[model samples]
Target: MSTLDQSRYLATPIPGPRSQELIDRKAAAVSRGIGNTMPVYAARAFGGIVEDVDGNRLIDLGSGIAVTTIGNSSPRVVDAVRRQAAEFTHTCFMITPYEGYVAVAEHLNRLTPGTGEKRSALFNSGSEAVENAIKIARSYTGKSAVVSFDHAYHGRTNLTMALTAKSMPYKHGFGPFAPEIYRAPLSYPFRDGEFGKEIATDGALAAKRALTVIDKQVGADNLAAVLIEPIQGEGGFIVPADGFLPALQGWCRDNNVVFIADEVQTGFARTGAMFACEHEGIEPDLIVTAKGIADGLPLSAVTGRAEIMDAPHVSGLGGTYGGNPIACAAALATIETIEADGLVERAREIETLMKDRLGRLQAEDDRIGDVRGRGAMIAMEFVKPGTLEPDAELTRALCAGCHAAGVIVLSCGTFGNVVRFLPPLTISDDLLVEGLDVLELVLKDL
Candidate 1:
């Protein structure tokens, strides 16, 4: 058992003297483009607690943007990394090759949502994984056009910048991006004007409308793949209505378009399932995974059908540091910990607790327009009371309040009006409830 205490303890104010000093130093030393949600500097983090340089322990609800689903500094991951480092840190898988890399690929091939023959190639980040998946799809199909949805956030790279939907921070003035990428409408049940309250019953129709746009605008014969997040992360944690994913997957199959599920923030037991696509029984041709894959170590993967994955030639898919031995070891141990500790079930339990508490909050506050998501990946969208108008100002205020009270929260959405919660699976019930209590108090004040 771990000895780390999971609780919030504010010694001084948030960003106390030590952290404030570091923040000042950071302004002078670091780039201005890098943004931070909280001003505190972490001394250490374990399980659900982040101990700042000033000794203030804050409840971590963001999990470093869903990168530590198993937990920050999880023992298994630390142990594996240490053992691998003691043996050898980096041989560069391309040059020397390592068993850990093969083992991780084998595990991903078996674990990702398919029973058929599958293969995986590791990468350094989600953007790299997504880029490689697109390359493989285009190579296999001999097509140039690719499709992504509105409100999607793939990454910051040139190709992924073209794929991402939001523009302000990720893509503004960063164009001209890669060509042949088309945008489609996602099945957003809350804001779909056509169906309104009946969106749940109109999921199939919503999907057909989006597909119709693609069919007419891009044409089926010219498209290489259709990429999407199983449950969008930075795009407000939007979970499509039932039948939406299935309809899209069926259309992709009919049109011979590779259906790619970007599970960067929704994979590895974070969504009460191994992968979010599994929840809807939609098997994607290529699945891009990262964030939670290696317990915070930089690791990503593109796992998919053997036929498509094998389309690339020798030296066609790999990077110098793509599958670092330490990261591979960490991933293997992290996957072991998730399975042995039953974190998938823990995620479902978190969903129940969060929904019960946040649902009551929604009932009491009309400004909370919608409370949606799955497993530990839940979010609340703020709107003008009784109206669909997004309230970004209210969202900012609520997040600031939480930060001041020694709780870590994060905001997302194209409009920046959604508060997302992605707590580690190892968090205790009491600590989770305490975090929720802070949020409830903040909401009441607003």
Candidate 2:
């Protein structure tokens, strides 16, 4: 028997009664800083569907912002979480290390794409992981400068906020950011009107331009790390043209700079391989990960070559709740599920499905300007017909229409004009097709 459920709701309208009550209370009680992505209040979720308090069932395409790649409430993950909680939950790894934490680290070191003497460190969120990676890189190289790119969304912490390039809400009013952090151009082939070209030539030119900026501003000798998201998450799921990662890796190596891949959104088999960098056969000096590592648990990690990581002093790295036992256990189980169930291959299958369906939509509608991304981390860009200008208005309308039609999709990009898809790898084909159908209907209106 299949372990799945697909019962649609009988309710007339979403956020019918109970959800509205919670929304009213929440708005009054909670800080507005905590943004709401969807109107419906989640009561429960399983497989690929979320049930709201109002008894409305909707297909979840965002997967809690790409954190639940293996699906919510998987038997292995739930049992592991329950068992660990029952035994013991809090024992700071710093005070007394545990087996689960070490095991998870071992797994990360072995799995992350790189052939070197590897070591790993754990943290609470993507932001924490990124910050710690910077610390390690600086300590190792004795350098002061870090470089990022335009439209990148690193995190909300002060340091990451400075590293991040977006403004308003993320960076606005939070400045006089950390010194020694800089920004460069991203290889947005589509926006540059260079799509359908050889990925090597297009991507190499972009990387060369960034190298020029680094040499002129920071001087390669002053740089500690060049941090990049192999596949940018908040920046429109922007997959750099092919050859971009390899070219950047070469530049970093030549300049004696540590290359850091922020794999927080693209790791754990969310892409076809275990890591997005694998697609290019490139190895980063440091790899930062989170999100799908522990099936919703608050866990993140920094794995890389041991020399750089160990350069920090004896007590240079650690946190009180860095590797909570429950999260460690969940991570162990999540990795097991990914291996045993062949979810990496499953992610590739999702890519094929999305391309076939979204490609058809683009063929029919001029607003569907671009369909891009790899594996299950997919996105589409909306543009005015026969023009390169972004149509953020159309993107918002499409997202709103999808929400009303019982599909939850997310809009991203510096201009807020790209719809990114991050459905769970285990999402059933029937439901996935239904969600895509709903998205197509919305595009029809546009």
Candidate 3:
């Protein structure tokens, strides 16, 4: 197997004969509940392109749902994983510890927001990290009620499903969720009434309104933690108005409620900063991270204040495969790559290019209700022209068009009318522009 070409090439149809064969096999072997955005099967991926089994190169704008920030098959991550695998794959940190796992924890402790004494616990996925964070919060605060915002997506587990707000695929039939999880209003600037007109001016007020709701509904004295995405990921890439985070954090501090920043998708320099909370100068009490943490490895972590993290009893936080040596090695290398290669700065460059291209598209298309996000995590919400009514049908058509034309884009939003762009930070300017060109053409056709 050779590295994929870092440019678009369609040797066959979108889901060519080979991919169709694989898709057929998958349908027979895999569960119908597993959703696939694109029918093509990937052979290999590098930089910003995914080469399908049929030899079609598609520009990857989704970046495996923001997991491949450094890029697919990153040399540093690949080398680290190979070397660690040869040495040792797993020791199950709980039973027998490894240097790599400790090193990764140390790195996360120092890197995540807040200069205070911090500690970390690793997990295999974002949902696990979030669940652990909640557990720690409850243990420390001695409270059971937790608050999550509307349109927020923590994970798919039973507890996180209760934290999540979207209904259809995530929480349609999975009813009778965990108890004591409450929902609060989020400061969605694009959709919020009146505040959308002057976000900067009304942000504080919006924050106060949300806080008021939480105070009234979920009493401040009864809350363990207020979990939120610094910049919401699955909820259409919604960026809260300025002053909103600060106000919420302040309220949490005053009321002794832990503020947990779910940086799973927005961490690891995806938002031009190492963590999204850094952009607002807010230091969360606890931070949940995953996605880009180990480039492409299965890793997640909850890093927080020392006292709170230490509140859990001995053997309370360890998992069999939580901090596997291989994944830890990849995380160490991924962090080093981010710092040495200056991928944080690269994310800002990608943002500039995206804003320039998508801004022009938004100007041309009235259906583009809003264009928002930071760094490489950008999105455009679709709606009826000159109206706020969501146009999910158009959003789906545009994504399908991009897929057929050898570009991979993802859709989100509570109303299912958001098209998000999360290209790898390592994507070349030419490749990024080319992908955006395909998106522009698709929008125009729609």
Candidate 4:
């Protein structure tokens, strides 16, 4: 829907005149808690590029933190939203009910990774879905304790703050977090290498290490859920070791624990698979999805086993704007576009291209500690030239250089040493390679 060209073009400097003016106003008006990665304010966006207020067509590698998977202003989503708004925006799905909400729940139940009888409840965001899932697990199993892994980024809510691993920025001084939330070790191959070779190679061993701690600290009998991101997002694009996810799922199955996959960042074909759990053949009892569900619209869901989801009583799970009609319409259209466009396969192709490119770069540079992730959701972890020590300096420099060159790259990780790349699946081959070209130049300069 953008009028500007699809490729990268900078008519002015990164922030430009108008963006600088907006930035000045934002500082005066907006809260400091919210931050933006791209320096310029967006005027329009389509496919893989964002046109800033100063008439700069910049490559959007971040994809609005993996939210705009189907692409910004997708025609299908736009038309659906327009049509739904023309009729009515909301009648409260909880009070009056609507076909759109039911249809979305049906789609999630069918498409999610499982053949069991399933049900879904829609929410306004990933955080809400997560909190509700935990509540459902507790109600069904009558357990109060929960286990979360290291390097997990759930959300900013009070309960999720305790669930998250990072301290500063996400959970700094968020005093006296929720009770009975426990932290466990993750199967981080790159970091585990420094611990021991056997642990690095065998994911089951790492799971055992965590499970033992869980047994001693939080006892599986009292545990309500084992919530985790299949691929850790804000902590870094960390893909666990080979058997990591499956091992944890197996233990959760043996116990009465609800294994919840927080697929907020990795769902909706953002990863090569339709869902990241499919890659490892791990079926979660409950799956929390958002970010990419309705193109750019705000919608989220907690889909799970029917018995588990049905545990809550009537009037238990909902909000004023949960499953808004407009967002539901947008979600249905987004799924249609994804299926019709063969985006899942496109993600695999992107993985082949990006991993191959970054793999070669890693071979050449010692500072590039690891290049990991699935589909278009790839990341590079920076470290000291000859050691495992995190090099956050290099990561920040790389991000700044990319922004200066009109390519929007994002930084992440607990140690602040990861540079993630999440280009829209609809991006042209030439444009994708051109973005990589910008990244290479940034690396070379750094």
Candidate 5:
């Protein structure tokens, strides 16, 4: 619906009658376990705007948590899905293979951060890719221990819950988690206090600190892999210290522990590069990618060194609908659109625009503890005006205010005091600034 107006419009109050009715239905029919960030219900989305069921055109700063980098219902992706579904929806790649799956794999193998021979296996979601990556790492290294960092957000599965660091919603009572998953300290420049300044300059110090713990607690011989998000998503868009990643990769290489970059949130040009690892010039032995891979389709891949990826035996690394033909076609079109539209560079432009605006806001607002992140994945951590103590109240208030004003924003951070922005790369500069304007007004009112 290119003819559809792609700008913000408010036809009714936030969560008007229709939306509230739907919400009532959802409350009765849906599981309470699934949480919602907004009271508004999406009816249609295009470009930078999500038209809610109440006909309120809200600016989409969350991009479905960076899933719609190419924008919601992208033309190329839609066309590809339509063609693929008409021909064949699913035949189960493992049972009866198809070229779309192979093409998608080739694209991932070539796009993911790395050089030399690489292999790829697709899955339905980020959790599946991560679980399989762990399986492959263990198969290759013959180790049982995996190193996950603090402020990390992996997924919801049992094994991923063990790999993830947050409690409360993610891990609270979901205990008895998978064994052998160890947690390490991350190079959080904003929250590390004294070490924050040190790590900013020499991130290796932070890396060394975590490495020492791993070496002492979980010996290198027993370590299968070190999993981390280059630029964490749900865990507050925390970008690790500059040299921190290289040091970790080096140690993993030295100790023969597989280095896996969980780029699920930072992949596919979301971080101004094809992958966030490129910013550090670090080529992870294995990289897990999803989210923005196929526009908005469910697709994920674990692409890595050929030797490591091929370690698993036949039929050991796939799912029934892992590389469904429809998803693969969408992925191919998504890549083509990314390349043809130059969305990678567009992500860089969005970065410059957002950081410039938010940098000005942060300078005047002491409550904004820190402003950090790369590309469209930027975040502002909120804290007490004069101290480092997190201000979760203000964070929640700001998000609520934005939502009421028809701007879709999301919050994160271990303390729930970070407001993150993940607007689609296709958003026009005017629409983005309008969204930011709402945020500024909301913050001031708060």
Candidate 6:
């Protein structure tokens, strides 16, 4: 048997004794608006496992919403962060530009999907990166209309919310959104209904539909850019058809529309490629990336053509906390770690392993409506057997079961029926497979 740690508290259930004490304190002291998935409190995490305050060791499949792709407490990242902190933590880049920040930007310009005269500006979050991308697009194109796809999750900021599609939680009670943002259909093959077979054609159709809307409603001349998640993240990890992205890129090129690939969740080898757009042979005009950028530091960036990135007036794009030195150091170290450890190849290995396990589960159970994703960023959509209808209840149950079995899993999707797995790329194969086995057992119960 694999010697992976499967320690479970025989004393009490998870949120056991010590964690429950923390939860009680949290409910009284902290904001109730923020939700807890498993009601477990973490003490520390490394590689794939998060040891909660209760001393329950749970395999981390979520990777803290895919932020810690390299791993939790990676030696290089930790040391870099510590060293940077020792030197200085907060010398705002705008006030005094630092070498680490400049290095990170340069690295991003080189690493992001595009080649040829690229530039990058770092920000604090995915939303900020996205906001800057739009700013650049609008400033460069001299347009007001920005188009995004349905079921897309850009971020929580006002402009991003306007760009986002899901109405319930994202848009609910936050109306009077930013103007000139338009919504288009994403290629959700599993839920395409009538349009499933023509996904390629549908991509063109979605573009044409948006173009028609722009022509009639917003006007092509008034449109700034069309931003899309290369692999739609919180929106169900929807991978578009083979020709879809390329066709959309063609449309954008022909129409003079800036094609923005939101690599916030798919960048940094979380997907098989360094960037998801690379999978489709696409070189987007602007690429927004965050999430996995700096291991766990709050860093993000927009890298694009030099002319466009420089279009905005000097001092137009920046924030007080944007590209803090510590985060920059973490980012530099993360990049070095990715290359030095060959995490990109590791991501591919993870994809194969996950697909093999999840595919087998899918084959055995029809509740798994769809088992789809690229690389380690895999997800399975649960649905009522023989139907496309979402089974969020079963998804919840599966996640709970996995947690009980000492594995942490996360549920996503507009309908909350998807269980996405984003284990640290540095996770041991033994631990990863154990987590998969636990998940399989959970699914069987479901």
Better of 2 and 3 by TM-score: 3
Each model's C-alpha lDDT?
Answer: 0.94, 0.89, 0.92, 0.93, 0.92, 0.86
Query: Estimated TM-score per prediction?
Result: 0.98, 0.97, 0.98, 0.99, 0.99, 0.95
Please report the TM-score between candidate 3 and the true structure: 0.98
Off by over 4 Å in 3: 1-3, 194-201
Candidate 5 TM-score over all chains jointly: 0.99
The alpha-carbon deviation from the true structure for residue 296 of candidate 2, after best TM-score superposition, in angstroms, is 0.3
Clashes of each: 0, 0, 0, 1, 0, 1
lDDT of 6 by residue, 1-446 (tens): 12324443323587698888888999899997678888888877877777777667788889999999998877899899989999998978889788998899889888887668999999999998999999999999988899888789999899999988888777899888999898766667788755556643466655554456556766667788989998988888888766667877887788778999999999999997888898878999999999899999899999999998999999998999999999999999999999999999999999999998889988989988888999999999998999988999998988888887778888889999999999889888888898888888777765
lDDT of 2 at 170: 90
Give the clashing pairs for model 1.
none
Global fold similarity of model 6 (TM-score):
0.95
Q: Supply candidate 4's per-residue lDDT for 304.
A: 95
Candidate 3: residue 317 Cα off by (Å): 0.9
Task: Pick the winner on lDDT between candidates 1 and 6.
Answer: 1
Clashing pairs in 6: 214-219
On the 0 to 100 scale, the lDDT of residue 278 in model 3 is 95
Per-residue lDDT tens digits of candidate 3, residues 151-223?
A: 9999999999999999889999988999999998888988885445665347678788888899899899899
The RMSD (Cα, Å) of candidate 1 is 1.1
Best by lDDT: 1
Model 5 agreement with the true structure over 147-168: per-residue lDDT tens digits: 9999899999999999998897
